[model samples]
Target: MLGASTWNADRAQEIVDEHLSLEAPMLPILHALQEEFGYVAPEAAPLLAQALNLSRAEVHGVISFYHDFRHEPAGRHVLKLCRGEACQSMGSEELAEDLFTKLGLDWNRTTRDGELTVEPVYCLGLCASSPAALIDGEPIARLDATTLGEAVDEARGL
Candidate 1:
């Protein structure tokens, strides 16, 4: 399906069983599983549904709803650039375009060297700061082209 070979049946089931036992929010658990594994395996759907007493369609729907859930492995680092109104007002749109052009990649695409994954996020709760971005989950504000480049370099250990 989707030619996305990221899901491992056995691993997905294992993660589902273990994560569901914790009684935490399913979204968080799903996120963790995706983080640990590269993507949420398809087999996780049934297990998650059974554990949460939800329909399989419901579980699938949640996964599909969030942009964060990937059907493929991300590169070594994830660059989540905010596209909220504040960030937009602060020129994030141009900055995003410049970053993509410089990297020769687009949103949800990994670089050829597997060094980075560029993605777009909505509001990161740092709208006031504007032009916020997260490089591997560390949020930073006041972002410009240079700072974004530095963040990418830092994440890649380059």
Candidate 2:
């Protein structure tokens, strides 16, 4: 996983300022902030709203609407499990439930140790290899409980 800096209002403002010239720049600004800080801090909405002349609600709506935009920092590693129809048909729902139980996490939640966060992603474009997952952005296809558990354990450095 890429290292992300702690949230800094000044740095966030710099990011927002850098993207302001772009047409329809809200998404870019949000992405930039996430890239720099690993998540969009709640404090960012007011700053972005002021910079873009938008309402805080408008800025927050965009963040909440997008599944990829996290309001809080994720753990050292992120695991995105596919939940698209293809994967569901291939038993991803059951797999996800079992995994969540084993990890003691709900959706989009981090482990107690802060080593990993598990999120649901719709389709990884691996329909042929249904029930796919991505660990820190690296694709892992043809998943099963054992393989997925092993991957998670490895990511957590177990």
Candidate 3:
């Protein structure tokens, strides 16, 4: 686990060294940090700022702006349900409510078991097949209660 303290000068250089050549530098670095550490430790914001020559606020802003960046730990499986207009038009709101009740969770929150998380995604770009969702990042379309339940069960390895 990369502790927050480890994100100081030395690690800043490491982040820069790894992604400086890339067109969008921070993506890889942040992804690496998040992948290894579970979340980007607060210390990373400043270190990334210095390495990227961006203001600390800018670095923090970027992290906060992206839905993928988690300041805290998340469940092993994240269920991102689409909340876009197309989805909502197709009864996604009702679906979302039912999902929350079934999972005993609210949007952007994790279940008590720490195995599943429920999050709202604006769109999955599968709007034509409205009421889409992603289970552990895999697109699932035409979700109904049974399909959603089965997917959630599968995600939990049940």
Q: Whose TM-score is greatest here? A: 2
Q: After superposition, which runs of candidate 2 have C-alpha atoms over 4 Å from their true positions?
A: none
The local lDDT score (0 to 100) that residue 147 gets in candidate 1 is 89
TM-score, every prediction: 0.80, 0.93, 0.83
Instruction: Score residue 28 of candidate 3 by CA lDDT.
Output: 85
Off by over 4 Å in 3: 1-13
TM-score of 2: 0.93
How do the residues 1-158 of candidate 2 rate in per-residue lDDT, one tens digit apiece? Answer: 35988989888888988988899999999998899999989999999889989999998898899888888899999999999999999899999999988889988888898889999998889999988999998999899999999998887788
Tens-place lDDT per residue, model 1, 1-158, is: 11224556666666667666565569877876786676776767787888789999999999889877776677878889999998999999999999989989988888998878888998899988889998888999998899888988987888
Q: What's the lDDT for candidate 2?
A: 0.90
Give the least accurate 10-residue stretch of model 2, judged by summed lDDT. Answer: 1-10
Model 3: per-residue Cα lDDT at residue 12:
53
lDDT of 3: 0.82
